[model samples]
Target: MSEPARDDASRGYRDHPRSKPGPGSITRRLRRHRPHYLTAAAVAFALVVAGVSAGVQSGAPVDSAAAAATPSGTAAASPLTAVPASPAPAASGAGRAASPKATPPPATAAAPKAGKVPAAVAPAAAHKPAKVPAAAARKPAAVPAAAAVAAPAISPELDGQIGAIIAANSAYALGVSLIDLSDGVVHGYGVQGNFVAASTAKILAASAYYHLVETGRASLAAPMGGTTAGDQIRQMVQQSNNNSWALILSAVGYWGIAAYAASIGITYDCTVNLLTPEEMARTLELLYAGRLLSARHTAQLLSYMQNTNFETLIPPAVPPGIEVFHKYGLLYGNLHDASILVKGSRAFVFVVYTRGLSESDMGPRTRIIQKLTRTVTGALF
Candidate 1:
């Protein structure tokens, strides 16, 4: 103590001017502040751990080895970085168990292969759409019905028979009009030619009278001079009385009958008093349809036609006792017959005009017309 104290005291005294102070005092002070340093270090370590934790949660890369080795470790430990060298069998066992559990999930994910079976069968199901158009395609089958409506009402067999009759009988310039009211068939042979109307003009006279009655210019029941208009009409129609017909003609005049025929769409040649068979047939058709006269006058006219003195043409061929409303004409070698044959409720008209027969008598022409009538009726009915 004496020597060291004496040296210390000497050192404490003024030394060399260039000598520096020793760090013994600073070392002692640092030892006293060791707790503060430890506290600061602990705070800095906590802040670094917090920053590493935030980076990991935010999916940022972490590169701190100390932070990785900490008790609260991070996912920054990769197989290539922090994996242990040995004692790795337990981790490998865990991975194997996880792999086995995941293997079944991959097998179950292959269930989409079963969906391909339905895709293969879908084409057959698609065939049902094609069947819808087949039902729609069946509508054209009804065109036959329209064709039936447009077909000619005249029977082809009846037409053939009448045509044969006209072709065979070549001596006469013959005209025929046959209308089957039941089927609305019209069979015309030479009906377009101009032929003497004969007593058929009496029908025009009756129509003119009726037309006058319809217009209130005359009356069917009123007397013309001594007898009623009905009486004169009856006499003219039934007997084909030339006197009665002349009287009616004088009253109605030629122009009056012509106007009436024109009104009903009949083409009449006023020069020769000729009317075609087609026009005559059309006139009778209008009469039967109740277009030419009133029911009373129509009945009056048709009633007179029921009983005729001549039954040589259409009447003899038809059934017995059936109403054969007809008229016949004989003038200058021309023999003509126009009739309405009534059976049950049906009525048909036949008008045949014939001239230039070899017989020069009525018998041969009559038989010819009668044969034609029977042939036509047999073929048609």
Candidate 2:
């Protein structure tokens, strides 16, 4: 039989006279291929290192890569291998891997649809306020008090001053009544006491005659007691003429005067010539207010009352620029004056009555009335 030739070179060992087939020969063969084995082992180790590095760089778990490399199917169902792998980065150059600590791109929030508002986000827990105590939360805030209102300027002290004035003039029986038109307050002492009206009662007579004229019961031009009623009224008021006053009184009559006084809400005894200061004041107040007469008749009567023959009491004490419409009365022992004092839009009624003096000696009582007038004007205006 023929034996085929074997190539020692292909066997990775050359035939050598010094080499013999044995354990030493095996050792020689291994030594001859050591570099190739070492190169292959180094390549495998490098591949394993590269796989672990890729797992880390791609954000996959390092153990997941280890589990993937394991041969048991048990590793496939392992919790580590169940995790998803991160997408690999694009290869840069030939074999460059991504850095392990490389930051990923930030995730973007979805935009809201057109015409729709996005829901507001809740405040972060760190920014939330602390809870208030129950006592502090239940407490109420304080409120300010309201301001006080001022009182009206009414003088009660004037009444005492009037009493003192009457006390100072103790000899003569005196009565006074004053009305403050500004505040509608009346101030006086002895206002209700009866006093002799004297010629001041002429105002009542004149009023009665005018009342008849207004009611169509009498005519101003008609003759009464020897003169026209209009001429007598003018003479009675402006000149204090006794004859004219008597004529007008006769024309109106005592009953007519009493009826007129009752109609105007006052008590007057025309026969005795007695009336109170308060009644006199009320009569003048009504006259000034136009309640007693028409505006034309009122102006006409007030015109007659001014600058009369008697100017001794109220008008002389009144200050300038103030208009005084007044009448004075004198009898046996009675001295009296009733006046309306006016300045601008303000006016008041003042009536002063005094007795216990002879008609010829009225200076002392008249001066006392003047003093009272000055005191009242100073206190008010």
Candidate 3:
């Protein structure tokens, strides 16, 4: 009807090609006629099963499974030994609380050096059993004057300013103290060498207490002795409150403050809180010149001190813009102590302390301090 359909002829040629394995056109006939082919398929399946069984029986360990089955073990560790004997609690942070008796590694073990005792340590040979007599002991060779190693702790000019500052500031006792924040120089007046802090001692307390607060070891808002009046001790001692200080002393006992001071690294002296005008100056100098811990901490502390009650001290004596954060100690002019914490383009300590006999004595005292503070502040700050 259509020339025998050319497309159908082509399809038939490809499907029934003489050498091709075409899809079954007669499946029923193939099933009945190709029984030998079905038997060959069964034999091939049996060989595959045998190969699989052989592989399973092999003892070779498989990495993934073996690792999962193994157990984990650990090496022994130990603690540190001996208390640290370093200055300033080892600023390097290398020394922390270690085992009390555990020996350290060989590389870390260090032996103490020989003592530098003076030759005079021999103690007069025990009076020589009076081998000669008491005073006749040959005067012990005059005991050779100790070789005084004059550590230049202060300069001559600074020494005079220190005295002038102390003499003028009736608030201070045992003279005054001046430290050059620009450089590590220190000078003291009055009892030039001996230290005295007085109410100014609160500065150290403030320092230690603040440090503890900053480190999270202690809380500021925490009550010292409950919410009662006794709680003032913390606020007063650390905060320089007469009433609070008395409360704290009573609660902790007389020795409590001393013990606490020692623990915190501030060597407190009962006499005037070891506030020699000189030492006060040195303390401030160390604080502002970035010589103290981290620059940030020193700056942070200087900023905090802006609230100090002391005013007539360095803050007023120096030019405007120069900040003075410090505490003022007084007793109807009988005792005047000023501990200034100053900061600005420079920093320094200027403590002018005195044991004024009369309230009027403060007139000259203020003058001396103002001049000294001005001199130092002008040069450094």
Q: Write the per-residue lDDT of candidate 1 for residues 13-40, one digit (tens) a residue.
A: 7667567557696788789999999999
Best by lDDT: 2
Name the runs in model 3 displaced over 4 angstroms: 1-174, 193-196, 211-217, 224-240, 247-256, 263-266, 269-274, 285-304, 332-345
lDDT of 1 at 32: 97
- Candidates in order have lDDT scores of 0.61, 0.68, 0.46
Q: Against the hidden true structure, what lDDT does model 1 obtain?
A: 0.61
Lowest-lDDT window of 10 residues in candidate 2? 118-127
Give the Å shift of residue 105 in candidate 3.
31
lDDT of 2 by residue, 1-381 (tens): 135788778889866776657768888989999999999999999999998889689995445466556664224544324544332222222111222221211112111111222121111211123355899667763531111111222244555566677888778788787764433344456535678899888888888889999999999999766778898899999999999987888888878888899997778767788888777877776666556775556667877888799887888898876667889998899888998776544466788888875876688888898888887766655
The residue ranges of model 1 lying beyond 4 angstroms of the native Cα positions read 1-153, 183-185, 269-271, 357-359
Taking every candidate in turn, the Cα RMSD to the unseen true structure, in Å, is 43.0, 44.3, 29.2
Better of 1 and 2 by lDDT: 2
Model 3 lDDT-worst window of ten:
90-99
Model 1 pairs in collision: none
